[model samples]
Target: MIDKVIEIEPLDDLDFGKVTAELRSKRREQDTIVLFHPSDSCQENLHHFIAGAKKIHGSMFDYGVNWDDLIWDIRGFESTTSLKDLTHASNVLFTQDNGKGPKIKVSRKDEVPFAEPFATFAKAFVTHRHNEKPKSHSNHMVAIKALRLLYQELPNSLTPCVSQLLPEHFNKAISCAMGTQAKPTLYVTGVHLTAIAESLDEYRLTATPMTWKNPIPRNYKHGGASQNRGGKEAKKERAKQLPKTDLLLFLAALWGTYEEIEERDKALVCMSIILLLCGFRMDEFIGLDLNCIPSREEYDKLPLEIDPETGTLARILRIRVLAKKKGHWDEKIVPHCTVDTIYIAVERLKALSKPQRLTAQIMLEEGKWNRFLEFDDDDYLTSREVKEHLGFPGASATNTISTLALHGIQRDPSSLKRKTRFRVGDIHDGFCDRYRERISPIINGFGHDELIIPIWEFLTLRYLNQYTPKERLNVFAEPL
Candidate 1:
């Protein structure tokens, strides 16, 4: 075999090319051996190994030259100067695939004991082995075993000599890749080092250093666009439901008939509607006060309007009423009389819940009496006092909402003898406003006598008229 040098031209005048040129020039002058990694050894995939080499060179292996430059003389001569010849000379050893070469079969049972972790690292290693190829599902088993060996051996071989002798490129590549997952990231050799440390007194072991890279995209979505796992699924499912009109009626009937629910249920429902309609998060829902409710007058001034001349008279009449959220209320509303149900509901709820006014003398007397009152005096109400009155069941807000939504009865508080008479009225006001905004256009467009809507949409349409029903449902409903 003739030791000849072939000048490989630079692809670009970059820092990388400069580095390669320096290394090649030095190697040619000194005749310090240059090895071209073979394509036949289990580790012969030049692209994968080189990708890893490049990655490492950028980081901990900055002083190390890329193996690509050493292969200049062997580029076109496949039979004589190839990766196979280099493998025979043992200048380059691959991260073996089972006991077989590069294209061998991978067996699950033959995998390292920590199979999942081993496989995870193996995939990453193979990715580097194949020139950092985009990960695919093919031949994952082989990759797993190779990583297991790397993780098993690298760390316990001691510092100075062991670390110096080891290929820093291989070590760095393995460590960097492990950082990509949500696991106890074992450095390319940390786990192996720790295990080996027990048997040998010569080396030190440490966990893989925590490393990170920019996130890579994954196929988290299961199916089509909106039908995928998350918010899309919720939207799709909500769209399939018969519409809000019927759902609200059902809920209203349930509220009116079920007497078991106390004021707590009413409060929870109030918050739920506000969040679903308004796109409020859990914390926002919990923090709401009575003040957020909009006035009926303000609601009437919203942008929603219906043109009386466009559709059939009966059709126009049937669909003219619509719902509107407070934010979308604008000045362009025409034909003065669009009715807003949500605003009406809020006003009604507030009226029923308002405290009765007292004369000055009576208030003075009551205050004086309260000063001498005991725990059972029936005057001052503590947080516990209110909860007891409302029959609240839980310690935390999450549990409280969960309990109320599950078994609580819905009620129209504006009616006599119902704690939600206040909320019941508010619902009507809010619903009316939302209905005016949402329905009138569709009714004027299609000329329908009645409308069908989802319960969540009914609430959201009241608040913002922005989110779809499924989004509202996710905000409003718990897992149950």
Candidate 2:
């Protein structure tokens, strides 16, 4: 066959295009392991593929020998390199081929890996020189099937050379070919092989004679000493609860010009106080509105009517709260005399009636709402914002408290502003002046209905319920 060029009709002489056209073309969109079959392979096997296109019927009539009729396993496999060498080797073997015999090919030195183990290397060497006859037809099919199954479970990370698969890997593959119906799925098996190959590669790269062991540990630890060496480990855990004093300094520096940035300053001060003391989620403040407060008259009204039964503050101011509960936002009201910090801030804003401070109208605009307060267009300040403001995140109440510590905000059982202890009446006066005295009577009057809103409903509608203590403390105790 090497000296004589046969002039016979090419295989295309037969009108097989129509039959081959019926076979599906196979191509890969990704590099991952997958199965492959020639375009004219069996229609039955095509339909049998787990994820094959459903349009092809497996039960269709089977006929003809065509490229499409050939199927091979290709999962986790790569094509062999140096095809030109193999073609030359095959041609040399074909020189002695008779009309009735199978063609032979010259085997290249590189193709020795394809031959079975224990085969004579000398015989293989000569085969490459003269080009030996092709192996029996049955042996060729078996080899093709073996190659297909091997690739399906082969790890992509492994070198493309077949010699890379270790003895254990080869054994497992052979078992897989003969294994039961419970065999691993294509993905699982392929992943396992890939993982093993990668681990081996990593091990090989790091292996050294000085650190080598015959049987390595199953569970290896990295950076073993550094993990437990530091005293800072314990401190790191406690840092979560410890207050962040630096935050207060940062905030003071940023918003010190309250007059220049009125609305934002007020919002920040109020939000910081609420978050620090109440431990409420930041979004809770996002929903607050003017109706969240009670009027000055109401604060002075006194819930208990002097019945002459007992001379007491008559018709005392009763505070109401709406809060979310049991998966439902609900309304709850209670009578109270002392005023809360939130009430004080609102009252101050009202009393100051400063044009710079945020008002009902200004806070409503989506774009303008965040002007004073630094926030994204979405109106949400992320934990990172809090961390950047302070040294840590703001999501936690504890963090908020520490942030205020630097600003002279004393934290303990009592409510105090720096060194000054506030009385219930003081808080009350503060609330009324900001809310009732300054707010137009018409506006204050209009807010009455809103004050009665259930805490849950209020919360849902952008209103918050700040908690108050049973009695207002007149002084701060340093140690007692």
> TM-score per candidate, in order?
0.25, 0.22
TM-score for candidate 2:
0.22
Which parts of model 2 are misplaced by more than 4 Å? Answer: 1-239, 245-263, 304-327, 330-340, 347-480
For all the candidates, what are their Cα RMSDs to the real structure? 24.0, 30.5
What shift in Å separates residue 474 of candidate 1 from its native position after superposition? 30
lDDT of 2 by residue, 1-480 (tens): 479887866777855654333321221133333233323323322222322221122211111212122121111111111111111111112011121312333334322222221112112222221122223223233333334344444354333323244535444654664452122333233333343333223222111111111121122122333344356874585576666889867655544554565543555565565455444443333333345556767656546565333455454332232231221233222223324554665554443333322323333222132222343332323323333443443345455444334323333335344332223232223332333222222221111233432111222221112112311211110000
lDDT of 1: 0.31
Write candidate 1's Cα lDDT for 137-195 as tens digits: 22233234324344444443322111212334344545554554323223323433332
